[model samples]
Target: MVVWNNSDTMEPTFILRAFPGLEYVHSWLFIPFCLAYLLALSGNVTILSVIGTESSLHQPMYYFLSMLALTDLGMSLSTLPTMLAVLCLDAREIRASACYVQLFFIHTFTFLESSVLLAMAFDRFVAICHPLHYTTILTNSVTGKIGLACLLRSLGVVLPTPLLLRHYRYCHVNVLSHAFCLHQDVLKLSCSDARINSVYGLCIIIATVGMDSAFILLSYVLILKAVLGIASREERLKALNTCVSHICVVLIFFVPVIGVSMVHRFGKHLSPVVHILMADIYLLLPPVLNPIVYSVRTKQIRLGIVHKFGLRRRL
Candidate 1:
């Protein structure tokens, strides 16, 4: 969600330099970000720990389930430091190479998270949509393979970005305008033409996040058709209920990400600060909100947490 400031193109500085000074964010921003960063980490960790500590959760479903939680934790943690710095200090400053590196890993994790979610959606589709073959189809071997594939898919596609960026020699206007180094922002800083980076970046998006999202949507579409055909009213209600939480999660991920990207790309001149704020909000929203949505809507998860934590059942 970082904005690329091309206004400094005329400046006699290194073309590919990072922000020299930190733009200290206001206290208000810091307070929320501090809480959000902590919550995102804590919530995801709690889920991962729950799955790890409880023997009952050692099944294939929970393995992928825990993986998703772990991916979320990593994704959020990757972005939080810079975001928090943006919130806490008036000036946001990071080294050029470090900024780009941070950005690369951030995108890498983001891609991994999307892929994991797609796998989880497939798990749900198998369990609910094809109950008979669920165990056979989603065995330990299969889950492991899928997990490895997700990792490789993300790394394979996104690895080229940093490599490409490194090749481009940054020559004036070294300082980045945004708080974090984004590919687009970094590309914008390049004095040289960046057609290759742009093409690769787009391809990476299509391969990683875009492909994962398409599969997730397809899984749901099949899920919807399958659930709607159930004869019993109670059964239909139950099926719908099962998907409600995930639907919310998908919305949370799809809406803000696409929205912020749209705004950042087209709405650049409208309000750069708003652009920055939207990017921050979009990036953090899913991590902060996913646990809340799931807990509130999914009784099993909520009760599992309580049971695992030794809490009394509540009405």
Candidate 2:
């Protein structure tokens, strides 16, 4: 009923489907995706530039924001080429090596985002709960160390994924469900037993994102407690106000992730486009929305942007 090819002899190309039932309008789909890419790239780049140039913003919180911007930039660049090829030129065949590379970056930045968000929550916790010690606690060296640790943690965990995936021989339908490669999507197309991949993938999510989310929640709970302890309502609101952007970033990042997971697990009977769009949203939404949320919610960041772009007089 089935066959598996040897790893060495397998053809290493996959067809990336854009919209399963809406292929006729593939030409038109290019415009929105192109605009999304442009927005994600420009927004994240502007945030990074503003943070880098604004001396007053060079603190732990902004450092974490810079990390978030860098992560979004990485995600945008990771998918941009293949997405453009698929949507614009109708070029969908991605080689296995290339696919694995893309998968690595996509997943790496995903975990990096989780780690950075956790770090940001901790930054907030310290800034709110112990304002006197915030500077000494999260000094420049300490922030740099934390950023390095996040990068190392993400890389150390994700490095084995593509290697393990490469060992599996893919001999069945090589059509990918989305325009980009994902571990789960690619693994499903393999003819070999992928219990190891599946289990490892699950474990990594639980260990990384799961643990990070729990810690973030604990940080917020402590933040809430700190805010409530303030004597005045105005003080409480001011303390909580600083967390709005991080909370928004966290929601946008996690909501679509949960949506994608739910769709993959329970939406088997639904249209393929639903799955594709969910996955696309999960990948694209955070990067496109993070800078917008920050720019809108954080006054310091807004001022930094204005000063960096010489827009104060214009406005």
lDDT of each model, Cα atoms only? 0.74, 0.91
Candidate 1 per-residue lDDT, tens place, 230-285, comes to: 99989988877877777787788778879887996799677566776677676788
Q: Number of the top candidate by lDDT?
A: 2
Stretches off by above 4 angstroms in model 1 are 1-25, 89-91
lDDT of 1: 0.74
53-167 per-residue lDDT for model 2 (tens digits): 8899888899999999999999988888988888888888888899999999999999999999999999999999999999999999999999999999999889998999888
lDDT of 2 at 146: 98
RMSD vs true structure, all candidates: 4.5, 2.2
Instruction: Give the TM-score of each candidate.
Output: 0.87, 0.96
* The candidate that achieves the highest TM-score relative to the unseen native structure: 2
